[model samples]
Target: MLVPLTRQKFNQLIPLIATGPQYKYYWGKFPDFLQRLLISVVIAAVYVLVRLFAMPGFGPILFVLGVIGAFYWLWGPVFWASMRNAKCRRYKYSGFFRGRVLDWWITDELIGKQETVDNKGDLVIVENREKRINLEVGDETGFTAQLRAPLRVEHKVIARGQKVEMLVMSNRPDLSKIEEITDIYIPSRDLWVSDYPYLRRDYFPEVSRRLRDRPSERPRRRRPPEEQKGRRVEEWE
Candidate 1:
């Protein structure tokens, strides 16, 4: 299901920049007001303390640095999200496509390790690890892509051959071909899996359904050879 991009549809996605789950990774689950309060307190303290103790020449330099740091800590994540959102504008068209999960697995990733002294005065190495889910999905075009995401509770239910939906982007006005893909939405489970939430999902299901039900015919393409069924490995860039 494909559709030509419109100014209205484009503006609707703008909220995703700040509301995406990826923002939690940057600043945690704290509420917006609480986060801003904490940042303000810290910045005020830095400004006051630096001015009180630093020597004449050094005080101005430290104050300037403090202001810069404050601005970054307050707005850095938003700035990054804005850049990503701007980048998406290059795709003049967008659409949803269906695929089946061909395979899935979990892997333990070592994040970091810290060396510490135990109560017994013995040295201990504490390791930090994260679990990630890896999925390989294929669409009707015979193209497959490997998607990796931080494992969540909902992901445990994902299985081979389960239907999956993804957002595809195209530069062409007609949406004749895909230029890039981002964000995977699992309709069965009502779950979204992605490193970053790129779609305004509230509008996704309806849009996908409407397009699929439209009377226009999709362009035809040759199917993969029968012998290649077990060996199909074409990947989309």
Candidate 2:
């Protein structure tokens, strides 16, 4: 049972949108090759030792064991690294629907900030400020939707005052899917710093000047009466 988001809930989620730290594939090199070579060498050495001890059959068994060990060692790291990368990857989407349909695809931070607990022990929270989403286990009744187990969430800290965007979805009454809450439009360091040196420095400063300043309202620009009238007349025209 998917429900439309209200305006008030949408406004609350505006602050949660932003990009996150880029993940680097650390084991993208030939570490596995070295591990396999090492295993093969060890196995061959063991086979030679067994042959010298009058055990010809043991040599073949050791060779087979070595081959199996080499494969396991070679691919084990690659498989584990790939799984880690996939789990950390983020997805963002626009809207949600009922009956196990695919929603939007997001590549940003999604957060579930718990706001309250209902009688059934479900968590009710504001999802991206567009709607109040709930998360709970068990049957979906008197609720908009429901999500099963295996829910995940991630938390990150950015420089304060950084602009972010957020997307929220209610998979179940107790679970609210929160998406990336950072300004994705901001260029990455490798991109901007290499091409635009001056602009790069402005993107991320060690000490934010705005944070150092005392709190003060920005001065409002006063338009002249004639300009205001002109703007109004232009709107009508």
Candidate 3:
């Protein structure tokens, strides 16, 4: 049965998932806070050295302070990653549902360029197009939910009048978020990133454990590997 996602739950999920102005979610770029953490490590080393030499008893305090600095710096990205995995899990599992894209619209809002790796492992650019897409999803139960997608053309598979398989929040079985636009159809890409909720049981879990768990979904050589042995492997369009 299709689980429902409530509007309220989606609201809470947003601030938790939108890691930064950078759209690394679609792009394979590391977490935004990663830079900050790297800087913190350097700062911590310098900071500890100064405090330890400047005062004896205060060494512990200085160390504590430095550790705190690292905590906050790492916290944001870690938290976001965890929550995103959680949602992804539900999306691939319990939240399994289906719906259709009633309509879609683009927004003028654009963030700076962010790097997102395509299935080809090429570093593709993901501009924050923030296409404001609204979809009306319905199931055999005659239940429907209005969903909005915050992703842009490059990051999403959504299109008007397209049938989609999606997942809802465990608690709220009516409203859904834009990320839940699982069964998306990108006309330009000509492939379904999400076709139905019947993905492998390990889909989300595999990703959570390792980013490289699944091979790139990008279309690879259609010909058998043996056939392409001597020539360049032609990519699927």
Best by TM-score: 1
Tens-place lDDT digits, model 1, residues 181-212: 77787778887887767777787776656655
Candidate order by TM-score, decreasing, is 1, 3, 2
Predicted model with the maximum lDDT: 1
**Per-residue lDDT over 1-237 for candidate 2, one digit per residue giving the tens place of the 0 to 100 score:** 222233333323222222122211222337645765677677667656665785666767766765665465444545554444333232322221221111212133343455888889998785542221122211122222222212123112222222211122332222233332111211222111111011112233311222224264332222444444434211000
Decide which is better by TM-score, 2 or 3. Answer: 3
Residue 137 local lDDT, model 2: 16
Every model's TM-score: 0.64, 0.23, 0.40
Each model's lDDT: 0.68, 0.32, 0.46
Residue-pair clashes per candidate = 0, 37, 10
On the 0 to 100 scale, the lDDT of residue 59 in model 1 is 76
Error of 1 at 55 (Å): 17
Q: In model 3, which runs have C-alpha deviations exceeding 4 angstroms?
A: 1-46, 53-76, 83-94, 110-130, 150-161, 172-237
Error of 3 at 91 (Å): 13
Residue pairs that clash (backbone atoms under 3 angstroms), model 1 = none
